[model samples]
Target: MQDALAAHPVWVIVVDYILGAIMWTLIGRAAMNIFLPEDSNFFFMRFFVRATDPVLRLFRPITPGFLIDFLVPIYVAWFFFMIRFYLMPWLLGYSVMGMLSFPLESEIAALLYQAFNR
Candidate 1:
């Protein structure tokens, strides 16, 4: 595990962290939309809208028109997920596709394992 962590430059980890955050945030926004309007004044909803609006807009051209407005976040999130899962590993010169490219998730899982096993 340490070797794997050490093999990548620090920027790779930082990129993973950022992309993971955006992916999760978009997912969260989709989930929240089930109960709240897009214009809702709730803090988390507001934060989600504010944070993910730019990403959604950036993807607007590629986003299918058939997808209803509520599903747009999930669709955008899928792009980020793919970029992290596939593109990042390729960038790091991994021969295998679908390698464990999610450093942020890896660290969290490791911490949880330590806490529960202790």
Candidate 2:
């Protein structure tokens, strides 16, 4: 696992971090929508809406019209998840298709493990 982390360039890690953040944020937005109205004016809700708007808009053309408005974030987040899980590994020249590609989460888990074990 350490060797896999060391093999990637810094930029690959940065890209993975960014994509993972977006993916999680979009999912968070979807989850939050369950408890609050879209126009609730709450800080975190507003942040989620503002941060994810552009991404949703970019995907609007491909997004299905039949989907409820609040469910859109999950739909769009799925694309980011796919890119991170599948495309990143291919870009990094991984010959195997099922290898883990989430460096950001992996690094976080490793850090947490070390912190808890000590």
Candidate 3:
């Protein structure tokens, strides 16, 4: 797995993690929107809303009006999910790798490499 990552430029791994984090944040923001009151003044809620709204807004024009407000976040999450899960792997030439496993393996490998060398 490390070899696969090493075969690519460093930016691919960086982008993969960034995209994954954004996907989860979008999902989290969507959930907050669903369960919490719109007026909820929680700091994280505001942060999520501020961070995600622009990205969600990009899709707003194509989204059907009748789909309900909550779906917008979910739709945005799915869009990023597709990019992270499908497009990125192919573009990075790791299409055969498992999405979740590769990252875990990379982390574990790094730890092992560090422990043994140091």
lDDT of the structure predicted as candidate 3: 0.73
- Model 3 Cα displacement at 106 (Å)? 6.9
What tens digits encode model 1's per-residue C-alpha lDDT throughout 70-103?
Answer: 9999999999988887777777788544444467
TM-scores for the candidates: 0.87, 0.86, 0.72
RMSD of 3: 4.9
Q: Taking the tens digit of each residue's C-alpha lDDT, what string does model 3 give over 1-118?
A: 5664766567876776677677778888878887785467998888888888788778889777898787777877788777766777788676656544445346766789999997
lDDT of 2 at 30: 95
Task: Please count the clashing residue pairs in each candidate, in the order shown.
Answer: 0, 0, 0
By summed lDDT, which 10 consecutive residues of candidate 1 come out lowest? 95-104
Name the regions of candidate 1 deviating beyond 4 angstroms.
1-4, 97-101
Candidate 1, residue 118: CA error in Å? Answer: 2.9
lDDT of 2 at 36: 93
Runs in model 2 deviating more than 4 A are 1-5, 96-101
Return the TM-score for candidate 1, rounded to 2 decimals: 0.87
Which pairs of residues have clashing backbones in candidate 1? none
